[model samples]
Target: MKISARNRLKGKVVDIVKGATTAHVRIDIGNGVIVTSSITNEAVDELGLKIGADAYAVVKASDVMVAVD
Candidate 1:
């Protein structure tokens, strides 16, 4: 798929938690690091996300904020 987002991480679905309207999907990108994304339940189902399923974490944002304490 061609997307405008350049930051794409390929990983496998590790866990999933579904809520009323949203769902938390976790993907392991290797080195024991996992990325979690909160998306709509319809999206989760439409993508057929499940444990051991291969997927990509597409990050598309205009700006990112970082704070150091």
Candidate 2:
């Protein structure tokens, strides 16, 4: 619980897909890493995001575009 965003990714919430108000949270920020976010759905039941629990996928951006072919 801090202010500044530092692209934190400490996760274990392996999946949660809802709609009609957004909710696509997936986190597994380990060796086989994964990080997905689409909050809302009442902030996923007011941050009681179940499914293995333990989460933090904060990726604030100002300018981050890396595309190659």
**Top candidate (TM-score):** 1
How does each model score on lDDT?
A: 0.90, 0.86
| lDDT tens digits, residue span 1-69, model 2 | 584765777878999999999999999989998888998889999888999989888876653457899
Which structure among the candidates has the greatest lDDT? Answer: 1
Error of 1 at 35 (Å): 0.2
In model 1, the runs with Cα more than 4 Å from the true position are 61-69
**TM-score versus the correct structure, for each prediction:** 0.87, 0.31
TM-score of 1: 0.87
* lDDT (10s digit) by residue, model 1, range 1-69: 698986789999999999999999999999988999999999999988889999998887653456899
RMSD of 1: 1.7
| Alpha-carbon shift of residue 64 in model 2 (angstroms) | 24
